[model samples]
Target: MDSLEQTMADAQARLEAAVADRHAAMHSPVVGTPDGDMRVMVLRAVGQGLAGLRFHTDARSPKVATVALHGRASVLAYDPVARVQLRLSGPARIERDGPVADAAWDAAAPFSRRCYLAEHGPGAPLPAPGSALPADLLARRPSLAETEAGRAAFAVLLVEPETLDWLRLDAQGGQRARFVRLGDVWSGGWVAP
Candidate 1:
């Protein structure tokens, strides 16, 4: 056991802890959407470090432009078993085309792709309430052309996490951890939970 080996072991522990923290955060009830609405789930995406988070919405969705204009948003997650909660805030960007979009489009499942092909965006008028897909279309799934159209309509949100608040619950007491990013550097500290 060398000093370098010890250091590497400690770093690995921290990374594992961070992932556990993220998983616990996802299961908590405190997760929130940008609209101040509480019913939405926050999905983290691939990028550099905690560089991206994704939320699916119609191209015409007001939230699409809202996030673009504000460039900042927040997420809250709570866990009962761990008695932990996490809150994250960061700047956001929209990726509409190019490799990023193509990759995400490729990852989407067929059912999800159908939403993209629909003519309406979020909250658009419905065709009566119980209307079925046209008979011919129902018999066959949407073709690649239709799927492509929907993929084009998708707007991928890339959020670059700037700060994170990690809260842990304890029977006797609690704890808090905060991380802030400056340039490429990440500085973190523990506080009262």
Candidate 2:
């Protein structure tokens, strides 16, 4: 709040906290693609100094293809209680097979992994509106072996932020700062709210 350095630090701190705590308001942030589509996605991981962010997705999903073509994205997270809004924009990539994707898939719970096992990718049409998961899987978690089929559809969306805008609102007024990343270094300054 006192300086741009502190503002940057606070933004990173909030993002890190969101990764560790699912209950955090920013845990599920809005991700926007070049196609003007946006969806709320879980915050899977965050790298040191806010270098990168990780999110899980279905490889067959439309967003994956959109991101692959555009190679860019925007993420927005707002915590009503804290009255903070964080907006991030940067280059993005999708990985279906990699150390990061493998580790994220492995770390997922059976129930969570079961999501990738859906009979069809997201937004698939059905004879009748219903869950995409198989009827049998609806009752219980799939075995580890069963989840293997989903690995092909599982993917990790990595966003390396090139810019970050942080805003804090209060009764008095508001504080705002903008940061731009060049290589491993960040330069930023306070801006009008």
Best by lDDT: 2
How many clashes (backbone N, Cα, C below 3 Å) per candidate? 2, 0
Ten residues in sequence with the least summed lDDT for candidate 2: 43-52
TM-score of each: 0.71, 0.98
In candidate 1, the residue pairs with backbone N, CA or C atoms under 3 Å apart (3 or more residues apart, or in different chains) clash, namely: 28-78, 175-193
Roughly what TM-score does model 2 have, to 2 decimal places?
0.98
Give the true-structure RMSD of model 2.
0.8
lDDT of 2 by residue, 1-193 (tens): 8888888888889999899999998999999998999999998899977876999999989999999999999999999999999999999999999899999999988788999988899988888988999899998989988888899899999999999999999987998889999999989988889
Candidate 1 stretches greater than 4 Å from native: 1-39, 42-48, 127-145
lDDT of 1 at 57: 51
Q: Pick the candidate with the highest TM-score.
A: 2
Q: Residue-wise lDDT of candidate 1 within 1-193, one digit each (tens)?
A: 1332342233324333543455633532233336664445435343344556565555676667777776766766555565656566788767777787778788776766776766666666776873233444555577666677677678776666777676666766866667787875657776666
Error of 1 at 177 (Å): 1.0
In candidate 2 the C-alpha lDDT for residue 100 amounts to: 92
